[model samples]
Target: MSLGDEHDGQTRTRLPEGNTGDPYATPRRPARGSRSLIAVVGVVALLIAAIALANRGSDTPTGGSDTTGGAGAPARSAAPTAASGVRPVTGKNGEIPTGYARDEQGAQSAATNYAVALGSVDMFQRGPREAIVRAIHDPAVTDGLVKRLDDSYSAAFLANVGLTPEGLAPSGLTFVSRTIPVGAKVKDFTNDTATVEVWCTGLVGLAGEGSTKPVTSTWFTITEKLRWTGGDWKITGSEQTEGPTPVNGDNRASMADDIAKAVEGYGGFTYAR
Candidate 1:
């Protein structure tokens, strides 16, 4: 699904703040016997799943980076030019693929990346979100999203996460919701329409101390049915479903101090395809 999140500063988060708190969690107790056996099975499953996804990505011809520059020009690009935001860093959607997104794979990639961008932490900001929605979504969907997003960030909603009418935390809290598109493919494509599923694994939670909303993660598949309009793909209708996801690994959770440090030290990415 096109999951969304925000920082402590903005009031434009996708869902009401209440829905974000204690987000979509379930118990995960290791199976009774044969812990090592279970671990082995899980690791193997993850490896298999990763291989499959990598194959899909490799099969799909994606957008390429075209850099025309004088020496030391910083590439004239604000975002990284990769299909999956180059591994860790920050993982979310970037500006709509400008060129090279012409064919079916390109269309699918553009749609997937657009979805990830639309459902990103930047949407919590006013100027960026409006610009993004206007640029990516068909005109019809834009108005609805604007109005609905306004409501979703209403005073009542913001109150859930201890925000004021302006959707701001008391002092030091940071809201966090970011989606990382693992891979995407178009099940079907046509001149004027396409059905693409962007399988995304993402992190969602609050940053900063004493924040009610803790950072969490989720796996979902955002199936977007798009219509080609104005020379680009736009979402006509979309829905999310349970992921074709693998189980989480047994790595120890990062310490809270580390989490805070990472949040401050690291930066977000610009996704492409």
Candidate 2:
């Protein structure tokens, strides 16, 4: 979702006059035609050559032997897939995850987890939203940020997105909003401060029979400036931009009921690396 549309205090892009529609349901086109067989073969050859050249000088030893039956070439560094075994937080702050480490990797992990919290549907409500803000944000800025967010999630915005004035989905309808981090990078780092950018994709909207705002997905990047405070990382401020989005695939859209069922069955994750 656009930060201006539903998440943050930035100025929003106004729809054209009288253009009241579900903005998330933008039309999609079929993917472009594929390359010819010969073209594809040539491209694959080039890619193989490039990979071989790139890894030619790597020093890490590989498990397999070379075609000439000599010691194998070096292997590339493995990508991170699990937690670093850093001690985890012992508890939650009103359902917000906490107790992050006080280092660069810890900062990246904190930013990723915090992005999930901030982009969650829970942020649409008052009490959980406040708890989330207090848990993830720096104490120095929490009060002011809470007020800013309260103003941003105005009643008009809530009503526009099919929420009650109190930010609840009407009975029988489930509002789905979740952020899944694809990856995170430390832009800058220091003992007491860091800036991290987390690339994420999300689902948002209302789901139920006869619902107009069927859930839709969005891609965005959240950049957070953080500080080591209270023995862990806390967000000092943050901003979001459209995406590092890729071309859309030709997947068929699911029915609202199926989408709702899938969301309920598939739980979210606690991101760490």
Candidate 3:
């Protein structure tokens, strides 16, 4: 079964007050002249100039770099939605991504993709499940982790989830368990270790006519503590928790056949952060 189904400021600079007469002279009846007005206008102009400068800085093209504290310089902290520009890794260990860059972005990318692999339908099976565990987990824990996962996908557990002892769905049904990561964030990072949280939505169940377990969607977050091992990011530990779920929509649910067909027709993605 998919893990998703189970687990789940600002400083202000003071502007100069307009040059008023000396404090003693200020006691003279407020000047009727435009000195006060001029000061006000000057202040307004300065504010407008400051605002314009800020706007220009915000509008600078992201591709340009300004090393001299110019408008074109990138912000010290990137906007949350800004892309990392890291491409998806080209290497695959049995369809799981490998060879992640040794950086925070790479850690996030590995955590996201590893979550997908661990929550996959293949995890309900034996051979593919073992392969997945070995590929994504750190070498120090691979053997023990594989054994633990094997026990978790026991024959009775498979049967409970509407799968056969061998992890197959009944003749007419398609078993679906897929996790799609919505986004990833780094919780902590260092040169050799990183902790990432992957928010994901998944579907897990049997899809077909008269299937006892109709495919349903779930939302959850998977937190993976990863270590840089053997020149790549590998999961050292992981946890899942229930979602930041959205309110259910009013759209009608699709039929079993349609859901089954869609599952077969659509392909899952390889995620990057």
Candidate 4:
């Protein structure tokens, strides 16, 4: 996911000093591994952002819709969208769940599920990548989209990120890429088409002993253009933008084994609106 690019976008923040004798009063420089982790995570973040920027369709907006008052419209509240008591989807297209209702709630549900599929570690592999694209994308755009994604995940790019050409990690290492949707809301809805925004936080990197690229978390929002076709909602196109990122908290990072174990222990959910 990262190539150790020469981008220095990290901002170092210092916590307030408690007391002169306090051990935390004097901040120490991060270890060499910590520095590498930060740099690699930044590179991958930029890489994903660049991909989203390039793949965006002409009709897609560069940002999420503004909730503030505009064009004489009343200001919309910033509160989270209320759930509509919709149940989780009961159908499956391969491993991906399908069979969404034709409404705003269904559109939001589709967008969130698609976001998870798009951000998964499976997307790195060719076989699973094709299955995911075919399952979730509109049929008319599926082949072209698959080709584009394959090109994006070329062998050289995989090598740069410490994975094999087939997207497998080295011996004794585990690759992790998972997207957890924070929330989803419909932006525009119609009988056959809808636009939805899904806010997500994801983990992406390798995890294991002596792994230089430790797993890292990132926040991003994905905008999906969905069309109700073939008895289910399918993606026409999508875009992503860097987050409504929160300030970094003062928590110590966990060990790589712990991350790898957690990823394996916990299962993902079938998100619903």
- The 0-to-1 C-alpha lDDT of every candidate, in the order given, reads 0.47, 0.58, 0.59, 0.62
Per-model TM-score on C-alpha atoms: 0.61, 0.72, 0.71, 0.72
Clashing pairs in 2: none
The TM-score between candidate 1 and the true structure equals 0.61
**Model 2 lDDT tens row, 108-159:** 6688778777766676677776887788878898887777667656786577
- Count of clashes, each model: 7, 0, 1, 0
Candidate 2 vs candidate 4: the lDDT winner is: 4
Model 4 stretches with alpha carbons more than 4 Å out: 1-84
- Compose the digit string of candidate 3's lDDT tens values, residues 152-247: 556765665567899888899987766667777778888899888877776666789997666667566777889999888897776555577788
Candidate 2 lDDT? 0.58
Model 4 has a clash total of 0
